[model samples]
Target chain A: MQLSAGARREGSPWTGVWAVFLKEVADHLSSTRMRILEVLILLSAVGAVYAGARTLQQTVSEDPFLLLQVFTAAQDPLPSFVAFLSFFLPLAAIALGFDAINSEYNRNTLSRVLAQPIYRDALLWGKFLAGLATLALILLALFLLVVGLSLIFLGVPPNTEEVARALLFLLATLAYAGVWLGIALLFSVLFRSAATSALAAIAVWLFFALFWGIIAQLLAQAVSPYDPFRPESELRQAEALVAFSRVSPNTLYAEAIQVLLNPAVRSLGPVLITQLQGALLGSPLPLGQSLLLAWPQLTGLIALTLLLFALTYVLFQRREVRA
Target chain B: MVIETQGLSKRYGKVVAVEDLNLRIEAGEVYGLLGPNGSGKTTTILMMLGLTEPSGGTVRVLGLDPVREPLSLKKQVGYLPDSVGFYSEMTAWENLAYIARLNGLPRAEAEARIARVLERMGLAEVAHRPVSAFSRGMRQRLGLAEVLLKEPKVVILDEPTLGLDPEAAQAFLQMIQGLKAEGITVLLSSHLLHQVQAICDRVGLFHKGRLVLEGRVEELAQRVLGGAYRIRLGASPLEGLQARLQALPEVSRVSLEDGEVRLEATQDVRPLVARTVLEAGAALHSLALEKPSLDEVYARYFQEVRHAA
Candidate 1:
């Protein structure tokens, strides 16, 4: 019944959410934490792109999509631009949002803020939109910078399809960052201390980024045992392992980017030799097919973000706001 | 009524913060809620603001149910919490501007109102200074400025003078009177009886989550103590003056200590007592009618209720 009231009222017009959104955006932009994270991300991105551009030069004469390799190619001691993004985007998002709600509570300004004529829906939505906007802006800038640097280094402009695919990859990366931001926001709502929320968010990121692949491997070994006795069982075990790992947003991001950036990769799982008999060995798939391949991963990231956001909205609305 | 509550109650699981409370405040009246700690003053204020849903009953402000029309109601009602906290990193003007935007004021109008309120609260010089550098009194004044930003019809303040020095408290009380003169309904809550007694037109004494006594300060004191008069004699050792005062039929009871005589009388017996003191060879320095103080009234009323229960 409360949810229905909330839902019905959700349609009612609110003018103040935008004010909160603008203020929050300004606050996030001016924060020292965001500044530090921005600097760190820029340094890593520039390093990774420079490293990848140098490696792409060797294959520039034959490869028509040489610039696309700036996002995927990696040499020793440095990963690609996309790789650095996959590693640092979540950190930036969590840094931006880990104290989004709790900081207001701790500062004793939340109750006063809510006491204004605005509804709680506006407050939560505004903060979320501001954070997402900040993340999107930063991601867009970094993607353009990488593209520009690659354009100069590789001396080959990307074709329409390649540009489209890179843009899609950037969009996917934003969604992945959104998922982590939502997780961090959920922690912010659940904990009163900013330090606690920050620690919880990092703990979750560490689990997914560092330990999840190993855990999924161990889980597959335990559940779908490797019976070397049966050759088919090996494929099933590997499939089980990938399936388990897909639950982590990191895995989804990596898989989605691989599909978008590498058009030669047609499937996320193993394919039979007979199934690929007529397929061109190294020809890149069309952009539409790649998007179709990455659609499920993109949907997974979006759903996770939505689920976290919904939880935050409901909890924040029902809370007393006494602090 | 500017504000009305019908059988309002809030139960936090097993603990009832406020219960079966009914209050009616007319327009332009300064109503003070007087109670000790844990007496449900804050709970009542929260319920009235529609911040916390009541377990039973309803609250109406400006003829609109706060729960049903909280935004509309809040637009007309300004509230100052016991301890006001602003965004420390922001300047006072910036903080007020943020609240103004949230309240749906136009940018130009908000700027004008922010400047006006800052000047009125004597913070115009420091309007651009960060709130973190403000003292407690300055913060309290800034809080008042924030409350007045919207030109609200009703203002609810919870212990607006909680941490102020004596001089600052006096200034804050004077500003509250200014609010009253502007025809705004103010519902203030505080445990400082004397301060409330000074500015409040009518007072409600809350005990154990219930409104035990509600009336004007002087009327409540008279109602509780029955017109008892305290007379302070000029010199000590008024040994026979006490007996003579007790013998007068108008005086119902008499007690003497430290050159002061406290007498309970059903009517004004000051003239009769003065005559008796003079005839008894005792100098009558001062004789005045003494109604019970608001502090005594609160204490005695709470004690009687405790004893009865």
Candidate 2:
């Protein structure tokens, strides 16, 4: 500052945000629990790839479901290994993210971090970005490992089109995890305890991934049992159930990936009887075309995740850091 | 205002953490905010740092409104909480380097400054050790090292001597006196009277969330404590010496004992005292003037310490 009157003082940037971000990343990576969680997630991803490979072999021998496809890659389940991953990958993603924000608050570090030159938005976004980075690295490693295994077992590497489709699947699943990460952080900021946040997030996951479908099925049956087996009512009941399933992000991701992989799955309705149903009625688009058709579902999932993340930012800004 | 507060209050639901506090601490002076447990010392610090909003009036620090300019104000300040914690898994060098990075210290300078501060705080021996293994005193030193790494314009520390042994605490005070020599303002907060009394240029007394008293240590003592002088007589085998001393106007009270006299004077009358004892044919053995006890003055404000007993 100049000594004379009316002289202007120099300004400073908010380096506090960067400081807090580095501190948080350090804290998370420094813990043994982080390593344990990392190993657990990768082990599950590897386990899924193994299971998917086994399933692909059995299906190929018996022509299970008599599924057929136009492209050679689509002749069997696409992503040959990702089919296994989709089953348990959310657990890995959830474990990494469920308590990211809440646990910091629980440990009383959030207040200390923000007491620096940092703003609330930076703290929330920094943690999200760091966590998402960690999650992505794990997922990418598993993706590469799955591809290696598929090449080893099937004796053929994926073609360009197959590779593009597989990358899209991976991206879609990441977006799915991003949405849940945002949701988890929101809950974390809302709750003061890591245990509470983890429990609440896992409970929500159970509801969407498994229990929600069962409850919806029971509700749909009680509401209108219009016997979709009858050709007259087949379209309406199938449409109702499929629309209901799409309400779940898990359902959307699963259906989008399944349709992308299997050309014979014309509709993800009451059952996987559609490939065989070609002998009886009809089929929809080929696998690639079906993937393109499911683009909106993928977009919706990504949009929802981004929206949840934005809400978390707003709530974090409103919170007072007194710790 | 370098720092100002008017009727600022804070409450945690049913508990009023701080209520109706009004204080003004000016620039270029070491201000001590002294209070006991739950007296709202930390609450006031949090508000001043913009970590928590005040429930009542306004507060301004460094000529920027704390709430309105938190981002700017924080950049100009360094704070050390009572329970100082750091990235425990990182080495001291790594910890200080990371904080310096966050503060946008230029690369070469940040490393150099970290080294300087680590050496200054006497942490050079264990600079490479992870803070997880740091002793309590070592951790406190590391915390001070982090704040000093940036050379902030205003350094705020709460109970800085809490975990330090006498040698370390004395060294800490000397370091703060060095900051004062640089003309940087500091807020040295502690509940202990002697801690603040030792180094602070001025002290603010906090009781029940309000700043009940504030001034320079000597000035407040004189105003609140009045003046006192202790006079002890020796070799007083001379006859009628106690009665002769009590006969003086300056003496408010007098006590007599074996070969000595204790006088609590209402005014400075050392000359009269010496003359009276000598004229009475007794030697004046010892006389010591004392500063007013902050402990006594502070207890009067709390009114809970039995009114100075």
Ten contiguous residues with the weakest lDDT in model 2 chain A: A64-73
- Give per-residue CA lDDT, model 1, range A199-239, as digits (tens): 99999999998999899999999988988799989989989
Docking class of 2: acceptable
Task: Give me the displacement of residue A56 in model 2, in angstroms.
Answer: 4.5
Which candidate has the highest DockQ of all? Answer: 1
lDDT of 2 by residue, B125-205 (tens): 999998889988888888778877778788888888886888878877888788888777888788778765878888988
Residue B306, model 1: lDDT of 83
Q: For residues B1-309, what per-residue lDDT tens digits would candidate 1 score against the true structure?
A: 999999999899999889899999999999999999899999899888878889998888998776777888889999998878899999999999999999889889999999999999999999999999999999999999999998999999999889999899999999999999999999999998887688899999998899989989878866776654544445334887777778877666687656578787767777787778778777767766664578888887767778999
Worst 10 residues of 2 chain B by lDDT: B226-235
Quantify all predictions' global Cα lDDT against the true fold: 0.86, 0.71
Q: What is the interface RMSD of candidate 1, in Å?
A: 2.6
DockQ of candidate 2 against the true complex: 0.35
